[model samples]
Target: MKKPLMITSLALLAGTFLTSALPDRFIRDQFKKAEAQTELMLAQVAEATKTQPVGKPALVSPRTLTDAGELHMVPARDWTSGFFPGQLWYLYEFTGRKEWADLARQFTARLESEKMNAGTHDMGFKLYCSYGNGYRLTNDPAYKDILIQAARTLSKRYKPKAGIIRSWDHNTAKWLCPVIIDNMMNLELLFAATRFTGDSTFYKIAVSHAQTTLKNHFRPDNSSYHVVDYDTLTGRVIKKNTHQGFNDESAWSRGQAWGLYGYTLCYRETKNPQFLKQAEAIARFMLNHKNMPADLVPYYDYDAPGIPNETRDVSAASVMASALYELSTYVPKSNYRAKADAVMASLAKTYTSPVGQNRGFLLLHSTGAKTFERDVPLIYADYYYLEALLRARK
Candidate 1:
């Protein structure tokens, strides 16, 4: 019995060693693959640039491929416009390569005009992801000015009565004051704006929006509603709708990811216990869901009718993994890092594109919505996957 116990202990120690070693190996391989794929993507971008009409801001940045297998690009006004540049920024951060920084700067410069486009609430998604990463890496004074201006434009959508930034102007017929859980993500811009300019109004607005979302957007179980319509005049709730979920009551996977990331950042920026508690609760709701797959990537909607047949959203997993890595630092005793590792490993092993496929995107099978961009390689998916890898490296 003593001899058997000694052998068992040795086996357990070996297993732990292998487990700890896997992530380092995985991270290195993924970065190598990412660099190769990014090179292919850059070639594609260069070809696309040649076709751009003169004197217009070229939409050369890759967003995703269309269903027909052709590359799709969009102008800076598109919500997804910033992610490709953000990926370039991540590559620069990972490699410390001057070439990557030069490419990132070129692509990032295309979106500078979006700083004044206040018609939508995606200022953070558009500016922060592009210029925000650039600013972080370079501290370019011009980048700081653009970010501050973008924050000011984003602030224009904040209604004091509703206590939330309005998410859309096009859907006004359906909602008087629509505030999606995604709006939580845009708050980071406001917080950073305050940090850059020492303006408390941005900080106050961000806290107000976060507090309002915490109070109204979450279900009893901490799962979030996709959209919460507010009475702009009365500061009252009108309805809770799920624009991208299986149903109004179902948990949209990416929405949950957004909530988790948003609250985690909110806590980091403000050190508010409520935000931390909310972040933990959201994390619990996601990780403990019965529908969460063994691979740690969730279905497009947790309550989608297909269950085992439902499409997995790699984008959501990527975002969740990135957020969890940061969240783990805040709550070191929690299982967030382990869970993040599981997700990253799964993504690297099964969900990543081949060395030169999927139009050079790093990730695959990300659903943009239940009805649109299903099972495609989204640029944001790749961006967040790179972000998670960086966080893991740290």
Candidate 2:
């Protein structure tokens, strides 16, 4: 449902022992399990490629859970196109295998052009997740250029009047300029751009967007609305609505996860106390909710009308886990670390695929959208799950 962030908070390790909730053995075992599971899926994707009626590699499918339960991948241009490649990079980071590196390179190659595509706000998701991680691990000069290009493209979408990056180009009739909570997650690319080139333009854009998002995207409870429509001509707020959540008024599980993770990252990048406060408020709303599942994996929407029966979104849980782990670093007074650990624990215990199931994915029961794919295993879920694991011990 969303994308990258973090290592861990030193504040967390310095404050208290997280071992009670996330033990060393559990972390090692999950990686071991992930390695075996990932290898299986890699082979499965390769084999599936062999049978394609078209004469291309297997990475061309949507990489989404289909009606037939196949691990079909989409084109390199798809919104989710970067995830599977990004996953391969994570595999390389975790396992230290050259084969993973080779495959990661090949998959990352597929998205090379997206760095210049400004059609959407997710260049951060597309290029940053794959090449950003690649540049971090490899420091390839070529990869560095790609990351800069993508950051520049993403910056093009920023509306100076609104002080926010535009989320979508096609929703003009409904929103003069729609700014979604997910855009906050993309600011990392801008921050990276500034760091690489010493260009304050990128940094300024990132801070401005975050500040505007803080002003308009949240509510009294700090549970975020998915989209905030702004009058582009005057930069005025017009309406707030949810496109992926159950209803405009409900707190979508994944949307909240985006806000928590996004603001936590904002605080990390800027050391701004306001961002930390925003992140903490979001954390409290979700944690103190009456309907939050005991395991910490929330329902598709907190107020989706059907409680106890609504599908659990492991994707949201994975995201919240990763975010909480980072948020814990900034706030020593809260039990965010324990909550993050428990979410990962539940995923490993309940949501993980059996040895030969889930099309070789790790976590399961992640809802992609309401009334569709209620219990599918999504690639982003697997990405964040691994991320949370890596964060657990860092």
Candidate 3:
């Protein structure tokens, strides 16, 4: 009787220790380590980009210096334009370098003139990352103006019939106004615009769009379809297609990441219970999948099932890492923070290449889509990876 009682007590104590005592200290230590790593990484990047030539202004601007002492520009027109200004924003924050500030301003001006338009569903990436960071770092009103104009243009894509923002406009079509998982990310601009302009209209529209997605796009288990079409006249889901995934019903890894992150952002902005719940569900579904690589990066789709030649997406890892960090802040008791921290450490240690100035790209294996020639080291991966690092810094 005594021995059995002692064993029961020990089991109870162990449960208490794990369920309460261990996690607080563990989270603190995890944050401390992540902060230290961010400091080192920032120092390394600053040293590398410090003496290198800015190089001639290419339509595709050169972003980083090579390992061989050569200046190599990351191409323009990629989703990474958002990140370049952001990197400069960090440089300004770290070193207080006026050059970084000036360069950021110059780039914002260039990108605003070139890319701001209605057809872009990526205003958050294109504007928030560049102009938003510009305003945050330097307090330039011009950046704010650029953002406002971009917001108005993006808001124009809102379809009253579908109550969702349309993502693409191909040459053959006239505002064929469809929604993709990727659009969740772009809606942040509207949400941010609402904050800036004191306009609830943008906020309302954004929420309606998100609710539409919640109702139509996500599966019973909270796994998401990549693309869902809507009938313009009747506002009904026309079809679900796997534009980037393996099949209509298949889970596209990055799409899942986007929904997880985007819904969380929406919840953060609105405190909407549904968005938060959806984020949690999607996060669980994404983390539980067997197809995810051990390092926490995922192949383009979970059901890329039999494609031995299927490629992994470092972008998915980066986006999910950012989402995990945000979700960690929002849902503290879920142990989601632990998972996020682990993913961050894995991304920093494993996927990061040591070849050129931290590889001039944070993530190595990203698949853009079949149409964009597939499985490339995408700029958006670099963007989100850096954004995650910055979030940890904050």
Candidate 4:
């Protein structure tokens, strides 16, 4: 009996060693697959470009695929419009290919006009992912200008009384002034704006928003609510809601990822220990949750009713993997890198789209929301997958 138990222990140890040792090879293989898929995407984009009206700027950047197996492209105003170009930038960063840089530049140019679009709180998701990466890679002064302008535009959504940025202007009937946990991501743009211009106003606004969110958005267990509506006139909490989760109280998987990534960035920018602690707490909550699948990809909602039968969200996994990679750098004593590697490996092995299929998207099985975009490929999933791969390589 003792010999058999020892053999089982050895087998488990060997399995751990094998899984731990595979990330380098996995990153290479995944990038190779991504390159092939992106090549097909370039051709599709060219074909789509040809059909644009003579005077119109082509708004045909790929977002996802339709239920009929056709590609779904969106305009620059779309929140996800920046991700494909960001993926191209990551490809260039990884492979050092001049062609990828040229293509990235071309696609990134399409979103320059979003600098003045203040309709949404996704300036970071749109402009920062596109122009921010572009500026980081090339030190392009024009990209810097666009990022600064976009940050200024995003600041327009800030409600001083609420001490938070309003997330949705269109949901006026449902929310007086809603601040979503996802808004934590856009604070990165403001932080960058301060760095670019030496203006502390952007920094202060970002800090205020983060502090306010820290006070209001989190559960005692560190799982976050998706949305917190406030009284903009007096900075009072009106209600808390999980607009996209299973219930008003359930944790939305992607929203959790957003908070994890967002708070990590806040700590990076502000060097605030509270933000770092929040990030670690969120990581622990996610990793230690009983419902977390062995592959590390989470269901669309952590508390959704259909546990084993629920849809998996690869996008959330990708975002969390990317955040974990960055967080690992900040807290080298933690197990974040290993966990990130596990998630990335799972995604590489199980979540990637088949070669030259899924309309050239690199990942599959992401749920954009409870009802919409269920079990489909998402552009941001590929974006963060490429990002996590790059971070892993570093």
Which candidate ranks first by lDDT, i.e. highest? Answer: 1
Measure candidate 1: CA RMSD: 6.6
Candidate that beats the other on lDDT, 3 or 4, i.e. the better one: 4
lDDT of 1 by residue, 1-25 (tens): 0001121211222123223523565
User: Ranking under lDDT, best-scoring first?
Assistant: 1, 4, 2, 3
Query: Mind giving the per-residue lDDT tens digits that candidate 2 earns over 247-292?
Result: 9988999999999999999999999999998999999999889999
Q: Which stretches of model 2 miss by more than 4 angstroms?
A: 1-21, 50-62
lDDT of 4 by residue, 1-394 (tens): 0001111211232124223533466567778878999999888778766667667556747888788867778889888999999999999998899999999999999998889998999999998998899999999998999999999999999999988989988778888999999899889999999999999989999999999998999999999999999998999999999988899999999999999999999999999999999999999989899899988899999999999899999999999999999999999878888888778767765676667677688888889988789888899999999998888888
| lDDT of residue 175 for candidate 2 | 76
Off by over 4 Å in 4: 1-23, 53-58
Candidate 3 weakest lDDT stretch, 10 residues: 1-10
TM-score (all chains, Cα) for each model: 0.94, 0.91, 0.79, 0.94
Model 2 TM: 0.91
